[model samples]
Target: MTLLADRHGRTFPYLRLSLTEACNYRCSYCLPDGWRADGGPRFLDADEVRRLVSAFAGLGMWKIRLTGGEPSLRKDLTAIIATVAATPGVRKIALTTNGCRLSRHLPRWRAAGLTALNVSLDSLDRERFRAITGRDRHDDVLAGVDQALAMGFDAVKLNAVLLRGINDDELPRWLDWLRDRPLALRFIELMRTGDNGEYFERHHLGADVIEDRLRAAGWTPCPRAPDAGPAREYSHPDYAGRIGLIAPYSKDFCVGCNRLRVTARGDLRLCLFGDFGVPLRPLLREDGQRDELMQRIRALLGHKAAGHFLHEGKTGITPHLASVGG
Candidate 1:
């Protein structure tokens, strides 16, 4: 019962837990322009989350990632980290944030057993940053990066979602910025999700373009041991860690995808591109339903698709990425 293999025969050992669906910045790639403030989400209670992590660990999952509209926004983040760290089989605990709130939580987070950090940053220019994230905190994010490194976080990844007309031309510049730094620079393909579909059509740049630009900039693709996710990692000939191109949209990583997600509200999602998800909260709340839920999870994984159809013009979740924990 601890190990559940998917239809593709891949067993998932990682789980992405979305702490909340709330966010401060209305990024062009996530939320659209003229978005309303609809704060009507049922976030999982802290205790419930603890129980879920414990159960997942009992089920053979060892790597856990706390993500969100902004996971750093969760009030009990440190407590959640501590609880998951105590889980039996759990080996890795990480968080992905927009970098707007990372610096403030670095010291405390590291002390609580959180191991890795992935920061979302699109552009380096002040005006462009503001235009992209609908905020003027580019400097704040940069400082946050410095603060995270100074605090000794194991790995600090800078996530850049590349859009074609928007920031594609700045690829080399971004690479140069991280050339001397040890942090991993991840370039995410502009995914078709949320209200930001407009940018998908305008800013979608495949990994090939990114790779070509990196080579033209005199950077070599340092080979990496195979990794999970869509990003094909490459590094400067002499750079420390490496840069990764996550082409989730342009090039789906579903074939080797061995990860599943449980939304803050308790929905079990098999794939990021899949539309339907079974609600696990009801089962988790009932002891008698525990076995039933596990069976459902197994069945779901058995039906998992080989990969997502991102290149076939699929935009937005049948339920939107925000609802699906993108």
Candidate 2:
């Protein structure tokens, strides 16, 4: 099978599928005022998701990540995982969740072919966590992290969006806390996408400063870990796991971006920071149109932007991170 390569020759083998636009947390950076999925198509059923996954896998997609406002909020997540796992070309299945409802579903999800996890955790302090996420489930999220580590998932990554004056002071504490763990801690730079331009301007902290702090504090850069994603990984000589920095703002991390995002509403987003997407629900709903659907998908892939223009001060690509399956 031919790989899904864009005009820039970037072969997209990974797919990020948004299961739902609904989330329980009102993260200040992601969704400050909270979100409600009262109207429109709220979510795709397990079978619909399975068909879509199969279609992408058939196009030589190897890795699949289930994302959402909070993927764990979906009751049929395991079923979706099972279906994706059963697809022929899908080599790995991963999840990105807020971890609020992860503890109860970890084992089942693992058994259903969840090979890895990326839990969103911004702050370690209980009150600070509550303040950041607008929810008081910090301990619960930590418990989910602990459970994931205990369960020995192949790759358990912690994703923290570093914001100035919000969770920046906890960088040292974050490094110390993960010293004895086998999970990877990624500190993401704030991006000015969606409706958070003002919020980003106020709190955006670049990864350069964070790296400088780490280096000044004696965190040596170890050999790079094996991964295809965007994190620039590092480690302390005495630490068990590694530290990563995803600086999309201060630095361009999209040179080799090989992925596509499918929103919960079935829009095929060729570029995360692009303003346009192809509506895929209509094709998916039409039976006996897999061939045509695949063709349309391939054609859209050709239109993938060379790179996100956010570094050039482009905005309005997306309204919110939740809508873009962040």
Candidate 3:
């Protein structure tokens, strides 16, 4: 089997597939106003998804993460998960959501073949969570996370966008929670997109703060998994849970890039912040085009850049995190 390698020598074993661009939360840094733009009222159907995953799986991709504005919003998500799980060579099926409906739908999702999960939980403090995500469902989300831990998933991660004064001060609460819980919590550095420049300037906190604190407190770096996300994970002897930092602004941040993204509309985004997308939706329309689908994806690797240009303040065409499944 052929491995998905780019010109820069980075091999991709993971794929972040956006199922839809419809989110219910109005997160401060992400969709402050909720989803407002393109990429869809019409997302790729289950059959197209099956074909897409089959193509990727045949090319050495084993991990497929279903992401979205909020992936749970899709009613057919279970079918999508099952389709991916049934694909040959696909070993892991994961999903990232806002967690509003996690408790209501998790068991069904797990049974449908979801192997891992990530929930967008910006804060543990209810009011702060409401302030950040514009949703008063923190309690519900936390309960769902607790339930997820109870279920024996291969991995369960919590994602929080690191904001300067907003949720940055809430790490103590997370650390306290993580001391006993076995979940993996990751703090992602706020990224600049087509929009949110002013907000990014106001709330973009360096991820080094969390890293420094973790290092000082004696959290040892954990070996990265072959299909791990971009986060640098660390563990402490005293805590059952682990902490990870996804600092996109840090020097050489993209050097460890291992995953590629595809929008809900079926456009393949080589870089999350890539200025352009090579449309793959047309190729996904038919099973007979699997070779062409893989060919288009494979050929694009030769043009993949060494790294993203976020350091220069170029946010690319991404108007919001939800739009591209961030």
Worst 10 residues of 1 by lDDT: 221-230
Per-residue lDDT, model 1, residue 31, is 67
Model 3 residue 151 CA deviation in Å: 0.6
After superposing all C-alphas onto the true structure, candidate 3 shows an RMSD in angstroms of 1.2
lDDT of each: 0.75, 0.83, 0.90
Clashes of 2: 0
Better of 2 and 3 by TM-score: 3
Error of 2 at 103 (Å): 1.6
Comparing 1 and 3 by TM-score, which wins? 3
Indicate the residue-level lDDT of 69 in model 1.
74
Candidate 1 lDDT, tens digit per residue, 71-174? 87788899989888888888888888888876677888899998888888888888988998898899889999888887777678888888777777786576
Could you give candidate 3's per-residue lDDT for residues 171-276 as a string of tens digits?
7888999999998999999999887999998989999999999899899999998788899999999999999999998888888889989999898999998889
Lowest-lDDT window of 10 residues in candidate 3?
A: 33-42
Report the CA-based lDDT of candidate 2 relative to the real structure.
Answer: 0.83
Rank ordering of all candidates by lDDT, starting from the highest? 3, 2, 1
Better of 1 and 2 by TM-score: 2
What is the C-alpha lDDT profile of model 2 across 1-326, one tens digit per residue? 77888877678788999998888889888788898766787577776687788788879888999998788878888888888888898888999999988778899999999999999988889999899899999888899999999987889999999899888889778877988998889899887876788898899888988889878877776564323577877877778888888887654477768789999988899877887878888877745777877888888887777778887778646877888676
Off by over 4 Å in 3: 37-41
